[model samples]
Target: MNNLNKELHLTNRPVDMPTLEDFRIVEKSISELKENEVLVKTLYLSVDPYMRGRMSDAKSYIEPFQLNEKISGGAVGEVIESNSDNFKQGDIVAGMLGWSEYNVVNGHALNKINPELAPVTTSLGILGMPGLTAYFGLLDIGQPKEGETVVISGAAGAVGSIVGQIAKIKGAYVVGIAGSDDKTDYLMNELNFDKAINYKTTPNMKEALQEACPNGVDVYFENVGGEISDAVFTMLNKFARICVCGAISTYNLPSNEDIGPRIQRTLIKSSVLMKGFVVNDYAERWSEGIKQIAQWLNEGKLTYEETITEGFENIPDAFLGLFKGSNLGKQLVKIAEPTYAKL
Candidate 1:
């Protein structure tokens, strides 16, 4: 097989602070596949906040990305060569493939997707990890009940957007908080979130939450932690459920890791049940969650957004965009043409 030889690496060009060029892609040979391994070329690489956590050496749910080394994440790719019966050449698959244009990984790690059920990239977005995260996080953790009020921050992004809609599916009144009025409008007008609040434009977010909920937030699916969370925290009703998903607002902070809403006083008064989670905790039930979200989508009950960048080389920039709020739903870098998903 002819090797397509360029790969990206991290560059220190932005100085101590990491930036896109911090990684560079150089020519390399097509890796020799070991027994049970497959040489895969990435088709679409996902850019997510969890990748940002992996960039820093700080203690996190997983080991941080190694400095000046090739970084990897969830990606859709084509299997060019395979040594295992489970996979074959020309197979379109999704796995923990990385930033590179190509990679060689365990045959067990890759799951081949048939191209009729959905597009190939959907495996890296709504049909894959992010979809599962929103599904299980809201249903299993947040436990939204009918007629209850559910509020989500980062409500226009991948996870929060699904959380809000799933809450609506359960017959809950869903309110969303986003950074811009455009995002607010989409959440309300297009995504069908019961109400959308532009956090930056609102004079009093707590009042806005109060107005939206009317009865108070019964389930708070928090994604952006900081001032937005502080306001939502103030409106929590008795026995409220809180799922702490992602904290994009403070992700770029230079220091100060201690996190709690400024309105801690409200927690004591409301007796809210709060739990922070990394989505992988539900990886065991991943199939069930994904099927449910997909069924909702197929039935037109769930809608998703994807801010896609076209090319493999733009992975770093795509990941950076998450912190800047440049994406509408799931942010991804497309590396190849679509493979029709069958199931």
Candidate 2:
């Protein structure tokens, strides 16, 4: 086994949008396994927009990433060595592991993955956090009804895409708002959304939304917050529900520039229900969400897409790309190919 490993560390707190200089790759020797420890050879790792919040030292739902330490998120790997009875060589596992060529983690922190059931990458994507976020946020919060207008900002993203599909399954009239023409095409043609507006090209977002949703929006899945959300809010119907899944548009903005029209008046006038949430809020029922999403996937009722960056060294690029709308669905970094297990 190779004793030396490479790890990406946060070198500095980003001011606005992050740059490559904020991160540094450090090489170190892998320590010997202790009790209940497992040596994992990273296969694939996920890069998500939500991670942008943790880059700053401000208060958040999760802890901030300590400087000069390994950055961590969802990763899948093959176990090469294990000291615990729970795992053995060749077992594939998934967990919130460090961004590295390899990792030494406690067996309990990882969940065993069966590659035969679905692609292991899905564990970090549609079958994992993103999928669950879409499931619970849409069904539990948005609660789209039949023939209702459901509009989603960031509709081409990992969570938003799945939310749109699930809304369609519920017989809702789904309209998606994305950044590019290609993404708009993916939403309407590939995801079968009733309408898709390219916010970048659209001269009047509010007018486009008004035309697309003639009946007004009954459920609004808010992902990219800013002007896009402001447009969606204008066309919301009475008793509408707004599921606040993410605010990518505001993630990189400075405090002063993050201001927008206050939503209290709109919510009060329309009797709209707006609630923000993180996926762990539904932790008690994760299995239920995953099982239902998996069944929908298997039954051909749900589908997903991935924009995988090819190497571990490119993880930062993949993460930064999220703000630029460079990816269509889930963005991931392929760290290394599995040696102990077959895919």
Candidate 3:
């Protein structure tokens, strides 16, 4: 076994947008696993928009990444060694793990994945965080009834794409707002969204949203908050529901400058309900969400996409690309190929 490991550590707290310079690659010897621990060979690593919040020291639902310490997030790997009965060599697992080629993690924190049931990588994408986020946020928060209009910003993204599909499955008219022409095409042609607006090219966002949601939006999945969300707020129907999943547009801005038009009166007059949430809020119901999403996949009622960046060295690059709208769907990094398991 290769005892040497390379881990990515956060060296600096990013002021606005994170850059490669903020991270450092450190080479060290892998430590022996203790009792109830497993050494996993990372197969794939997920880079998400939510990780940006963890980069800052600001208090959030989750803790911030300690300076000069290993940055950890969602990872899928093959267990090369295990000290716990729950896991054994060659077992595929998914968990929050360090950004290293190999990680020694508590076996209990890892969930064993059956590779034969689905692609192992799906554990980090559609069948994982992104999929669960879409499922619960839409159904629980933004309940879309038949014939209702659902508008989603960042529509071509991992969570937003899934949200649009689930809304369609629930018999609602889905409208997506994306950044590029390719994304708009994907939302309209591939996902079958009723209408797709390319925010980058659209001169007037409110007018486009009004035209797309002719009957007014009954559900708004708020992914990219800012002008797009402002536009969505205008078209919200009476008693409309808004699932606040993310705010990527203002993630890099200073708090004071991130201010937008006050919508208190809009929510009052329209009786709109907007609630922000992190996926962990529904941890107790994750299995339920996963089962439903899996059923949808089996019935061909749902689909997903992934933009994978090859190589461990490029993980930081892949993460940074999220702000640039470089990925069409879930963005993941291919760390290394599994030696014992078939993928």
What is model 1's C-alpha RMSD?
2.6
Q: If both were scored by lDDT, which would come out higher, candidate 1 or candidate 2?
A: 2
Candidate 3 residue lDDT tens string, 138-245 = 999998999999999989999999999999999999999999999999999999999999999999998998888889989999998887888788788899999999
Alpha-carbon local distance difference test for all models: 0.81, 0.94, 0.93
Q: Cα miss at 175, model 2 (Å)?
A: 0.5
TM-score of every candidate: 0.92, 0.99, 0.99
**Residue-wise C-alpha lDDT for candidate 1, range 261-296, written one tens digit per residue:** 555567678777788887789978888888887898
All predictions: root-mean-square deviation over Cα?
A: 2.6, 0.7, 0.8
Worst 10 residues of 1 by lDDT: 9-18
**Candidate 2 global CA lDDT score:** 0.94
Count clashing residue pairs in model 2.
Answer: 0
Cα misplacement distance, residue 301 of candidate 2 (Å): 0.6
Which residue runs does candidate 2 get wrong by more than 4 Å? none
